[model samples]
Target chain A: MAKITGQVQMLFDLNKCLGCQTCTSACKTAWTDKDQGQEYMYWNNVETVPGRGYPKGWQTMGGGFKACTNQVDLSAPLPSINRDYGAPWEYNYDEVLTTEGGDATVGMLVPAPRPDAPNDYSSNWDEDVGAGAHPDAYYFYLPRICNHCSKPACVAACPRKAVYKREEDGIVLIDQDRCRGYRYCIKGCPYKKIYWNPIVKKSQKCIFCYPRLENEDPENPLAKNFCVTQCVGRIRWVAYAEDTTSNLYKLVNVWRVGLRLHPEFGTEPNTFYIPPLSPRVTNGTAPRIPTDLLAEMFGDNCSQTFEQRKARVEEVFAILEQERAKVAAGGTSELVDILTSYSESDRIQL
Target chain B: MPLWPKDTLTTGRSPRVLFVWGANYLNQAKGFLDVYQTLWPKLDLIVDLNFRMDTTALYADVVLPATSWFEMWNLNTTDLHSYIIPFTPVIPPQFGSRSDWQIWQGLADALANTGVVFQDSLPDGTTITRDYATLGTDFRTLNTDGQDLSDDKDACQFLLDSSVETNGLTMDGIAEQPARLLETSEEWTSDLLPNQAYYGFQRMTEHLKPLHTLTGRQQFYIDHDWYLSDFREELPVYKPPVDADLYPLRWITPHGRWSIHSTYRDLKFQLRMQRGRPIVYLSPSEAQARGLLDNDPVEVLNDHGSLVAHLCVSPRLPAGMALMYHGWESYMLKNNLDDTSGFKNGWQGPCTIRIKPTQLVGGYAQLKFRLNYWGPTGNQKDTRVQVVKYAGTLP
Candidate 1:
């Protein structure tokens, strides 16, 4: 393993996500849509937890370091082209136009048949299907992008060493010019972040919008990461982990409320999640999504991690509530000042 | 007053000819496409003037392309914002397409050449006949005679120069900034002003001036004849929704978060995030009762019509309520079954549910005859429906 320097990190608060997909659309329009090879690729995606994600069943295919044996498993079955990533569907508008009209009571308008096979699955195949029964079912959106890990498996498995972690920000990127179409990086990633571009005959993954980062001035607190600034829910925070004054550091290290996804993979992922808080069901009981299932997805410490995160979130909510009361009584509080000051100068520090 | 053109068409008294502009009837109206299909042969002509080759344009006897927004000069006023915005063209209209204003002008000129006469009866019982030649000459004169306001730019300039609302503002000024603040009687110190009254009502409190009302003051009760009619809806009162008890689920279709109405609904990048199809949201419990699951094909049916969409078990949605975001076109929908069909294979276009008409009684003060003021409105939210698992293939 190589010693990493200052690492850029991100935290997503699940409690705030509205599943609007503004972040996904923004990323696509900015980066991927121009290339024909990038049609099936989404560097960022929001999938419903406890549901089949994009590429159908991505969670079961395994890779990354095996902690029990203390060695990386380079061999893993690659994601399927047909079953995993569904072909994009195109519509038949001309058929709807040319069809003849029927009688008033029986007239109908039908379009030409859709292109069948190989494209059956879509990006959000299982949307909103949660784990619980009836009125008590609970689900939350889990937005995924490349983790840009401290110990990226893609870097280790590439035969040509095309994948490398930047020393400056610890962002993992594939060297497109140096790479051949071996797909070893795709199998090596436990998160399934690496995607194969058939047209380019190369492997590609998220670059954390590194070009935007290069343009950012350290002195400007308002200079934000692409996904963080584009989020309509305001759920994401991004900053270098070494920047002590950032909200990212305060939330991740000082408060210890942010939990890394699947820590057992031994990849040291930079992205973190603030577990969601579900409201009590209409049956007047605490809503529950089986703890064991969460543990399976998040690793063995899921219960303890969730408890610590929930307590800190409750504290923040209490402060917000108290400040709201003061505002109602025609008085201002410092809590309001801290929350409202999101301008460029106040949000970040070099 | 409650009569819809569809009802008239169904009764075999359809219009002789139809001319459509600035509206996508197939996309916005319920059961409109079906009606068009049935009545296409019966009608003499169907003309459409639109920018895109939308569903309605395909069926038109003559499809005249209109200028896109970026190629036209326009003004927009919105209640949500304080400024009046102007849209200046970036380029000329492409591929022989004309601006809506120019197209209408040409049509008027051509009709005048036909030497037609139009007769109308006035409110005081006076009948008047207008010669097309004179009417056309008068219309053209407004754009000519040293004014030279034949083009859209000249027309827009005249509007800015004449209106007191836009005092001290010009077309050039608006073109430079894209928006201008509507001037008020107050002194000019700031570029913006409060939307409503900025100060307290001193005239009403200190001078005791009468309000603009029927009694010259605020009145809680209305003494209008219609208000005291058999319905007796004189004062505001609680009334349950019309279809509250007819069906198990209340249907709600709110504006989509991705687009404004149907404006950007078809953007490929935007559609990728929305599962490439329309979705109906339901609670897990409600879904279980109907044998539905996430991404399962389901048909939402009511007396008005039936639409097929993939079901989504949304935890945020409440029980006994179904939600579908508005603005998906009929063509985008799958297995849009007709209401008259008895659960058999039917057309596969987008199916819009039935719309109910609200109260149409008018003629009272504040409710007198006016365009878009007092008329029958579509009661979209007042709908009930049942969901059944669909055993259909995707289109």
Candidate 2:
């Protein structure tokens, strides 16, 4: 293992995330557009929660550790290219377009399934299709990327030692040269962030825009990740986890508002999210998003029972409501100040 | 074309030329079937200028390639925003394409070479003269400022110098950062602050300025003869949709999340996030009742026309509504081996163009012909359709 120098963390404020896919588009344009197998890969994707996420039911697909144990769940399944993550289909533009004096027989321009990835399901196939029916239906955008965990399962599962967390920034990167595309990392990763690049015969994941952080371009030196900087909602904050003065640290440690996703997975993801607050019903009887659902996602069950986890979620929601009420009433709140500030200094401090 | 009807009433002449620019009117226009069948044959020429091979270009007599956003020098401003953003070319136009300004300049030059003068006798017995020989020269405006306005950058600068809101601003200044408009225009009903949020009708409400109306107090009641006739719609009233008897479900076409109209709709990355094609959303119960499961091909139709697309059974939507996000090109919804819903060519097959008679009234205050503001908006929301499970054979 390399010397522990630093670990950067990200804080995503779910309140503001609109799931516009601007960040996803920016990351795709910056990194993965040209590569053949990377066509289906969205290093940063926004999925509508309370829905089957990218790769279908990734939450229940199984991976990481079992409960409080460090043992990797041997029953972890690999996501299918066609069934889970839909193939990068091509449009029949040539046949349908009128550039060549038109083809009257051909119908509208539609997706022609790629033979390599003939797929029916897409990365966001269940978009906006939240779990309940009609008025009770609820959904929120969850923009995800490689968590860059302190103990990444991709690093542990790789027999070739190709996948490693950087000592400097804690960015988990797959060594393309060493990667043989065994795909164990894909099975081991609980978040399903790791993707198999069939053309390159290597495993790939989000690099956290390490080159931008390295200040490679003298003309436009960007210290923050492309996704964080290009985020239209300004929902993301990136900073060193050890920097107590940073909002990422304050939100996760001091304020206790940001919680890691599936903490019981035991990878200790560096990514922390400010859980989405559900609207109280018309009569203020129950939450639009059930507490049990929120708990199922963000609750840390390794340290407590499911009931306790649900209580914790409720407690956090209450705290958020209280702080919001205080701010709405023309009062002051440090948490609100931290979240509301549009300054890049407050959000992305390297 | 409908609003600015040339030689219609006074001249008693029909329009012979059509220039469809940027917009995909054939694909997006409501009651496009009427335009194609009734209006199209009467036109002598139809020219389309666009960066993409949009549906309008498919039917055009001549298709002129226009430079894209990244390949053009232009100024961007909208009624919704307070700032004027400048678009400086990142790269030169490729594949013999030219900017819109240059394309029109070329057309002027071509017309000048023909030496044909466009002369029209007015109703007052005076002749309206447009000498084609001097058109190329006049188009560049070299006589006034000795600057060839045919050049896109020069044209952009001339626009900046001409507009009172952008008079002092330069292309370079806006390129660095967007320049705020010096004053608000009538089109924008709000006063623009430096960085504050815009609240419409602030001048009328806060400063007591009279609005552009007869009574000037946000009056919706229009007691015009047209409004009082058979409709009696002087005040707002919910009239049942005209197509209610034709179909069972309302087709609500909302703006798409993946693409802005048809812009990036064909991109592989954008399509990968979606179901790889255009899809229609229905309530779970509705889908089940129609025997349509997720990813099942379905045909949505009415008296207007029909369209074929895969169904997405979603609980998020309400019953009695079939929601299809807008901007899917006609070329994308064909009846092929994969789709046999019997629709010939997507939404391009045609739909309703139900224009309210009250909207045609013009003599009243604030009801005059204002481009996009006060006009006969084609009531597309009232369009009704029946969703049925497509019994098409799968590959």
Candidate 3:
């Protein structure tokens, strides 16, 4: 593969996401709806955290690189389309609506859960059902798409060398002609973003709406990704990773707020996240989300102990709190302004 | 019924022959079961005009096939934005369906064929009397100051020309792109400045325009007789919920993430993300206490009525609360647990119409009766219910 000079990155503020699935629907309508076998695929999906995510137990699925190394693990289990990702089932709308007592008094509209495929799980099966006891319960929305990692495992795992990251913008794409439908890339991606198109007999994933970004017309206003532009919460920002002036860079580098997911996977994900903040207790000292859980998700890729990671996450929260206090006291905060991104230019700096 | 009270059913008159169009009131309206059971039997007729088989159409005596939004010409406006969006036909009406305007025109023609002449005097000493022989022709040409509006496109143009906000907007221009309002009206008392977010009451705050009140300012206290009477609700104050002590769980029905109210709630694509059915969400602790598991069909009941749906154990919900995201048709329920045996349908039926007497106020400044302007909203959040695991069959 060619050397990737720079990559387009995205920052998602979990605080703003309402989990309305607007972005998911937008992505589906724009890209996946055209194909036959992509019915069950969601190139972009928002799932409630602390719950079993899309493809069920994706976080535990063995894939990506070995910890603390740049080596890809070839031996990874493939998720069953029927069992892990529920095959798209349709309703008998015509039969039920036309049959006797079809007014739904007697002859009901039975969902045809295809007998060949068990419709047990879906992309957001356990949506909004987070973990915790009452009165102190906690949950946040995590919208997922292809990370377009700097060192993508799919690119490394493709035996036929079909998957490659673009040297100019670093968007990982599979060459349809070169791909032999080996299904290794689907297994290699730890995020489980890549899906197999049974009809086409190839793997398909998010392309980040590259055509819109690559459009030569500088006057075209709608030059952003569908997921970013259609996001109802306005929780997303996109820019070239190397653009130091962009808010994406400022949030990740200067402010030190945006953290990558599963750094141990060693993909160097271009997608960074501003972690969801916990409401302060009565004393305003501790965070509601267990420090261990936060650390487990957002901790460093280095060999840091659980205590060290916990302390680091706590310190990040403290910084957030201090900045919030500074703003409350009528002082200007760059972090707050960058995160808010009131203007369209602030959010989409191609 | 106080003169200056807050929140009441805005429409003063009871509707006998309801004509539901585009709205799924049978499924979405609060205390709908009560209205259906008691009031429906006494109603003269119920007609629903829809492109799809929605819950309202199932119960309606006459279901006229109306053109879908994609197959119609209409003007759409939003309070959140200043733009007047246009809806143009992507395709003509399918399967012999007619647009709403055409449907009414046809009805007028039918009435004219029956030779039934109806007349009513308007408040301004004008008469609504029309000869049955020319009813069809007059219905198309008479309204909106002698403009022909029998066709959907012509009606849309008439509406655009009639409204001050969209007075100058043309169909071609709106079809190309959404046009911003020409100016704010009395109803929307805000200046729609270019490149600015829409905020309510900008005219009063930013421009210092007089507010529509007796004092010509934002009034906090009401000095009406009913306000200072035995009720003594002169100022807005927190009142303890009446049903909180009686019922253990508060039943709150919020709009779902998958739908806009009840629209597209039954679409297969939207339901696939959900549990393939209507579900009542309970806190994990509440579910545990009731010996219920996730995906368990349960009956949520109260003094008003009962509804059967699948239970989703969600930690996002707080204890002492049962939440069902609104917008599930009555037909969505499979195992009917109502009193009637042999194949009945359950609905969203736990809510009761709790009309606070204070809400029935009228004849006060800005409190006079107007359709949905200032009235008691259908307050369903305060309803309380108990959820128990269902021992019956599931869909």
Candidate 3 per-residue lDDT, tens place, A1-350, comes to 78778799988988789888889989998998878999989999988888778888888887788875777876867988888888777886765455254333344555567322266667787887777765566777899999998889999899999998999999989898999899899888988899999999999899999988887466756458999988878899998988999888888888787877777777878898777788754445555666677777775453566677677677777778788889999998998887677877788887
| lDDT, model 3, position A141 | 82
Model 3 C-alpha lDDT per residue in residues B167-219, reported as the tens digit of each score: 88889888987778888888887987888877888999988998988788998
Docking class of 2: medium
In candidate 3 chain A, what residue range of length 10 has the lowest lDDT sum? A99-108
Chain A vs. true chain A, TM-score per model, equals 0.80, 0.93, 0.93
Angstrom error of the Cα, residue B162, model 1: value is: 5.2
For candidate 3, chain B by itself scores a TM value of 0.88
TM-score versus the correct structure, for each prediction: 0.76, 0.93, 0.88
Highest DockQ against the true fold, candidate: 2
Q: How much does each candidate deviate from the true structure in C-alpha RMSD?
A: 6.2, 2.9, 4.4
How much lDDT does each candidate structure score? 0.67, 0.79, 0.79
lDDT, model 1: 0.67
Spell out the clash pairs found in candidate 2: A108-B331, A108-B332, A108-B334, A109-B331, A109-B332
Choose the strongest candidate by TM-score: 2
Q: Write the per-residue lDDT of candidate 2 for residues B171-246, one digit (tens) a residue.
A: 8888887778887766567777767866678778778888888898888887777777778888888887774536
